[model samples]
Target: MSAPDLLDYSRRWPLRLVLASVGLFLYLPLLVLVAMSFNDSRQTTVWRGFTLDWYARLGGNLELLAALGNSLAIAALATLLSLLLGTLAAIALWRFRFPGLGLVSAAFALPIVVPEICMGVAMLIFFARILPWPAGLPWPLSLGPIVIAHVAFIFPFVAVIVRARLESFNRETEEAARDLGAGPWRALLDVVVPHLKPSLVAGALLAFTLSLDDFVITFFTAGPDTVTFPVKVYSMVRFGVTPEVNAVSTVLLVLTVALTALALRVQALAGEKLAP
Candidate 1:
């Protein structure tokens, strides 16, 4: 427990090796998948030569293109909706002291902590069984249901992120805006909204990625005609993995990495703003 007895974990070779092994264990398959996307052979395991033919085919695949469109649309709409609803939720909880504040606040965390399968099933029942579908129709389940379901799960994440930003906020700024003859709405827009921008951007991107990558809930909510990229990819994988799928996945991998990096950059900027 003394200063000399304190272990230097960074210099520990055993710990460093384990960490390296864990990183490889997690990311090695992704590296292999990226390699396979350019494989010339039909066989997934055998690579005859590197070729970009699969990417060409991916561009021409109508079903996949449609699915990609659907995914992007759903993700964008869900992100916007979640940003609005979650920001409002965070603001309410941040600024108010309700009778059941603890209970209401805990409710926001449920979507994050609850199992996805359970949430999916709950969504299925809510959309299918609970809602009164027309007598003959299949309730016209499409991007609509999926967007709603995604917003339900995704907004809580936005709320948590925004609330964290709000916790660091200086109330004096808003008070100063009010003292300068600004109304409530003016104070929020001029003072608070500017402060929330980094969190908002970060939350929006996080929600977009979560909605884009989601499968379980999307699977439950999708109609016969509705197909998002993840669902399309899953159906293809059920038959067999192909180079085209690999190519699309590689593109998605790159996009995910880019978005993640952007989020981190925003977070770093936010940290700089918070620093003394």
Candidate 2:
């Protein structure tokens, strides 16, 4: 090989090594956690032999199951509401210029940049001030407040993702639909929404994952009966880490991976549709 070819080969190996290192850095811990979940030992670090007892035990944990149910319920509700509101917001932001557009955009984007603790505290305080009940009432943490808090934070992410999709979208199809005598809403529904379906799906899945994984905001806003899976996991950890926690974390990791894969698949399909 020539000198330049040798130099190119040297650069390629270093880049490959760097990428490999980064991949291991991110995934090695996950692999360890998954392994630990199946370990027969109660002690997390010390592995005795492979067994399914931890996962089996999970099914019998009533509190964990209840918390998981609450999380799924909240995430589902929040994802639906966020998708509806976020899609509308993204459309409005992309299709029309209105007064205080910049301000409106900033407000929608604020939650993405704001610290979780701050948002959590603010929501807690806001709920305290506005909730219509006697101050002496029992701790009013309930499904409603948890869902509201989740939607508040998760909707912004959906909006941002959908808005990105809208930015690259072709508007001529909408115009063509209108020219064919479709009304504004009809054009949006018939022409635009089909194209945006992938982004909408991806955004909804992302919002669900975020809501499910959220601990900080949920911790502050949750009422006595509204504890989510993540909060329960946090409570479990406060005592000590165990194989049970590992099993739970491994399950959550699998779920998150599945959702992320689904999101990416939708985005890929969208890209294929857009491609010539």
Candidate 3:
């Protein structure tokens, strides 16, 4: 409507440019990896020709298949555990304000703020030292330890996400249910849970993604038999890069992107309904 207004709009072009640059910076490597995965050459940079040999090779690779299965198992378990614990913790914190409430919340969030390496190493030490070594640890390691570490790190994310959802939630609904003779458990199940379901799902997805992609903690805690995909990828990367790695990464990328989109769609729908 005005020259100054037009100028302000024109200046916003820089923000778009910056966002484009950032996106390219983040995704360009993934593009290269995806492209290279089709290369027939041993050299990553020099692509001789395109072929699906890598994917075919990956199909028959038992070790890779096993690692993928293990990763899925761990991620699923960690996500479920984190969602349950984090949702309960968030509810307790939100519904009741008591002594050390803030402290408890902070403790839950500590894993997110602390450095990953520090957390991973500390967890490894705790499991190996603070806890007694069994007469013999099965597999020389157990998925249990890895799952515990993942839950510790991932629960904070779930709690933070779910707490945000709870912040804007109306407690009056729960109170109304309680006034109607519904007990606390019934009120939660019938009233609070419906409102919180979207956030809980989002939190679970986040936990699953974090656990699936985790390397540092898994590296430290996973024993010889408990190799997850990220750890397997790391091991493969140590020797050299392979097209199979790219294929695996691409599969993971697709799964994560699909899940993220689904979660966002659910959140959008939930928000629309929840809005006044």
Candidate 4:
């Protein structure tokens, strides 16, 4: 509208252009993948007429469905186990000081910092060669050792999240509960749990997402009999890419995003409760 304003706008155009370029570079491929999932033609490079056949066909693919089922089952189990162990670990580290407590706390977090490949290999060895289980142990449960490995890694995330949330919580309520003749466990269950519930939920969703998306660790530890969705997708791509792959992947992507958003929302609610 004016000479000075126009000059300033022109000066800012380079930065805006750079940002737009970066955004497209990051997301353009994902936009293409989502679009192609509806393509009638199997060829990825060529755009064909739109159809929902790919999504419909996913229901009929038994092998892919089985892999998806395995992924969900492992993720669910991992979320529960991690929440239990990690919550206790967080509360313990927060409520008490003891000899080697720093070391112990660091030990809880070590898995997060370690390379995933290293963790996966270590889990594979620990399950197959080390930890002695019953001779009658079933395959995958005791063989693939996926859920165990998932818990080992994901629990650290839970511990860290819960511990951070604990910092904002005042312990006065727990003390009041104890003052009212409640036992230690009673106070924990009645008082502490309610306050910590939101963080726990956020941690559970995050753990589930991590377990669902994990590939390197699952790939290293899974037995021949246990194929999770991601590993199955990898195998499928090696053979050939199909519209079904795109459809399944789009579904996974949407699920992951939804879970992550819900986790963040729960976390925000927890934070709002802490605000004055």
Candidate 5:
């Protein structure tokens, strides 16, 4: 190899080492957690033997089951709501040039930029003070309130992803569809929707995962009866971390990995269709 090629290869090795080190730093703890989940002992310090006791324990734990159900319901609803609103907003923003468009977009994204803890506290106060049911009327402030807060935070992420996808869309194809006697709505539903599918799927997955894993925001907004998985995990950790908690973490990590792989496959298919 030439001297310059040798020099470039030498520079690349350190960068690769740095990248690998970063990945290891981020993932080693998760690996330990997963390994400890199978440890026979309750203590996290030493591994006595490998067993599935923690997984079995998870199945019999009613509290954890209830909390897991609550978290799933909340995440599903929040993901749906965020996807609907965010997709509509992204489409509107991309297809039109309205006054204060940039400002409106930024406003929509404020939830993502703000600290989640702050957003949670602020939303809690808003629900308590600014919005209240009238006397002799019903008020929804438990799970509903928590779901709304999660949707608020999750929508920004969905919008950002969908907007990026929409920006790269081939407008000429849409225009041609319109010219070929397709109405605007039909063009959007048939052509644009298909093109935006990958982003929408990715965004929904991201929103669902974030909503499911969030503890701080859920802690502030969730009522006593509406405990989520992360909140349950936090409560358990407060007393003491246990192998069962590790089991739950391992399950979540596995689920996250699976979802990410599915998203990647969807995106790859989308890219193939987009390639000229």
Candidate 6:
């Protein structure tokens, strides 16, 4: 081999080693968790052989199942609301100029920039002060406050993703639709939205995942009756880690991986469609 080619090959080894090290750092714990989920032993650290007892037990855990259901319901509702509001906000920010536009944009982003614990405290205080419900109300923690808090934080992320997509979008298509006698709403629905479908989907998925995985904000805003899956997991782990916790973590890991793969597939197809 040529001298230059040999030097280039030598340079690539460090990059490969670094990437492998990073990949192991990130995924090794996940692999261990998955392995432990199937362990027959009650002890988390010891490997007593493989079994499906934990997975079987998960089916009978009514409280855990209920928490999971609550999580799914809240995430779905939050994602729907976030998508609607975020899309509108992104469009307005992208297409219009207004007084205090900068301020509005900054306000939209405060949730993302602020510490989650701070946001949680603020939401708790705000809801306690403003909610019309009396103190005597049974099950004071309803789905409403949790969903609202989730949307407050998740929508900002959605707006930012959609805005980034909008930055690369062409405005001429909407103008052409308008020229053909379409109204603003019609043009937006027919032209702009189709073009933004990928980003919208991506943003919605992100919002849903964040809502599902969030602990701090959910913990503060959630009521006794509104326990989510993550909160349930935290409650479990407070005692000590177990095979059941490993099972739950494995399930969540699989779910997140599946969703991430789906997002990548959708983005790839969208890119192909946009290709000239």
lDDT of each candidate versus the true structure:
0.89, 0.85, 0.85, 0.86, 0.86, 0.87
Q: Which stretches of candidate 5 lie over 4 Å from their true place?
A: 2-21, 132-142
Clashes by residue pair, model 3: none
Query: All candidates' TM-scores?
Result: 0.89, 0.87, 0.88, 0.88, 0.87, 0.90
Which of candidates 3 and 4 reaches a greater lDDT? 4
Candidate 3 residue-wise lDDT, 73-163, digit = tens: 8888899999998988888998897999879877887889899999888988987889744535554245788888899889879988888
Per-residue lDDT over 1-276 for candidate 4, one digit per residue giving the tens place of the 0 to 100 score: 788877775358787898889999998998888889988897756887889999999999999998998898898889999999999999999999899998998888799999999988887788678974444456436433789889999999999999988997878988998899999999999988888887898888889889988999999888766889999999999998888998998987797678678777877887797685
**What is the TM-score (0 to 1) of candidate 5?**
0.87
User: Which residue pairs clash in candidate 1?
Assistant: none
Question: For candidate 1, lDDT tens digit of each residue in 41-132?
Answer: 88747878989999999989999999999999999999999999999999999998979999999988999999999999998898788873
Instruction: Give the CA lDDT, 0 to 100, for residue 134 in model 3.
Output: 53
Q: For model 2, what is the alpha-carbon lDDT of residue 105? A: 93
Winning model by lDDT: 1
If both were scored by TM-score, which would come out higher, candidate 3 or candidate 4? 3
- In Å, residue 11's CA in model 4 sits off its true spot by 11
lDDT of 5 by residue, 1-276 (tens): 888877775368788899889999999999988889888887656879889988999999999999998899898899999999899989998888989999998899898889978988887788778964233323233468888889888998998999998987999999999999999999999999998888888898888889988988888887667789988998999998778999988998998899888888887887798785
* lDDT score for candidate 2 against the true structure: 0.85
**Alpha-carbon runs more than 4 Å astray in model 3:** 1-20, 132-141
What's model 2's TM-score? 0.87
- Per-candidate clash tally: 0, 1, 0, 0, 0, 0
- Tens-digit lDDT track for model 6 on 99-182? 999999999999898999998988788777877333434332357788899999899899999998888778898899999999
Maximum-TM-score candidate: 6
Candidate 2 C-alpha lDDT tens digits along 199-230: 78888878988998899998988766678998
